[model samples]
Target: MEWFILFIVGVVGGVIGSLMGLGGGVIVVPALLYLSAYGLIGDISPQLAVGTSLLAVIATGLSSTLAYYKKGNVDIKSGLLFFIGSGPGGVFGSWLNGFLDAETFTLYFGIFIILVSLLLFLQNRLTPVDLPKDNRVMMTYVDAKGIEHQYGYHLPIAVIISFVVGCTSGLFGIGGGALMVPAMLLLFRFPPHIAVATSMFMILLSSTTSSLTHLYLGNIEWILALLLVPGAWFGAKMGAAINTRLKPVTVVLLLRIFLLIFGLRLIIDGLL
Candidate 1:
């Protein structure tokens, strides 16, 4: 029953996460924590849940990224730069996670979720800042339907933001896509599809590194991860297909609603 539950959760998480470029950690982490609290997982620690989520994110990110890449939605150069900055930060965050107790971790995770929710809610209301015309790292991308998008961004700012996103991902076992996608959209003026696709690529790198660090620290539950991967894989492909058909405003609204609900739930759980 527990394994079945994990699989179902993975399916749901992967679908929503892939659509929004999130690595499904927001869904997986909270769900696992709830199962553990209810004695379904036999006293599993929150840290273990988080670690397993990160491991599962590897599958989710890889599957979604491949789909996006084939559709030409991914921005490889930006994603690579983000990955480079995030790598060390991921390692450090994993190491830090080891020192936190379950209660403290839960509390902080709740706070983090709420903060992210607020950011998502506010993102659509904010005015986007365009990159200067003369920027050296301008990007022109053609999507699956042969639609072209042109944008530019300050590389240093992106790198710095990615480093912070990596740390958050490692700490919470999230893919950091929720944060990264919004930053790419608002700060870098990236098209919504491109931002989501690129975020998945970056999550692939960040989650892998973070998961390995958690593995070294003995935080992961391999059986749980095994159960989650298959569902996540199938769901990711479905979600990627759905993404290509959805409007950007619709996607953002869905993400905002999910974040708000999940974030509030986490906060309530922590307090109680």
Candidate 2:
């Protein structure tokens, strides 16, 4: 029964995470924690849940990234830059995780999730100002459907944001797509598809690094992770297919609602 539940959670997480570029940690971590709290999983701590979720993120993110890549949505150069900035940040975050106790980690994780939810909600309301032509780096890319998009971004800002996202990923076992996708849209001016694809690529890097660190720390629950992987892999492919059909606004709205519900639940659980 527990294995079935974990598989279901993995499917849901993989679908949503792939669609949103979140790598599924947003779903997996909370679900694991809840299962542990309910005594369905014996002696699983928040730290272990987080670490295990990151391992799942690696599989899910890679699966989604490949799907996105075949569609020509991934910006490899941009992803590489973000990866460089995020790698060390992931290490730092994982190291920090060791210092936090279960209760404090739960509280912090809940707060972070709420903050991410608020950011997603507010993103649509904020208007973007055009940058000077000289200050921006131009991008031209073709999508899965052979449609081309042209845009520009501020590279330094993107690197900085990616670094922060990396830290969060390492700390909480999230893919950082909740933060990175929005930042790419608002600050870097990436198209929705590009943002999702590129974020997944970054997640692939960040989650790998964090998972390795967690493995060394003996934090990951391998049995649980193995059960989750197959579902996550299949769901990622489904999500990548769905991404091509959905409007960007609809995606954001759905993600906002999902984040809000999960964020509030985490907060309530922490309080209890």
lDDT digits (tens) for residues 1-272 of candidate 2: 99999998888889888988988888898889888888987778877987899988888899999999998789888888888778887888888888887777877888888898898788777765566677767889776567787777677776788888888888998889988988788766788889999999999998898888888999999899998888888888888889887755776687678778877777776777
The whole-model lDDT of each prediction reads 0.84, 0.85
Give residue 234's lDDT in candidate 2 (0 to 100). 85
Per-model clash counts, in order, read 0, 0
lDDT of model number 2: 0.85
Superposition error at 60 for model 1 (Å):
0.7
Q: Mark the 10 consecutive residues where model 1 has the least summed lDDT.
A: 247-256
At residue 160, give the lDDT of candidate 1.
84
What lDDT score goes with residue 94 in model 1? Answer: 88
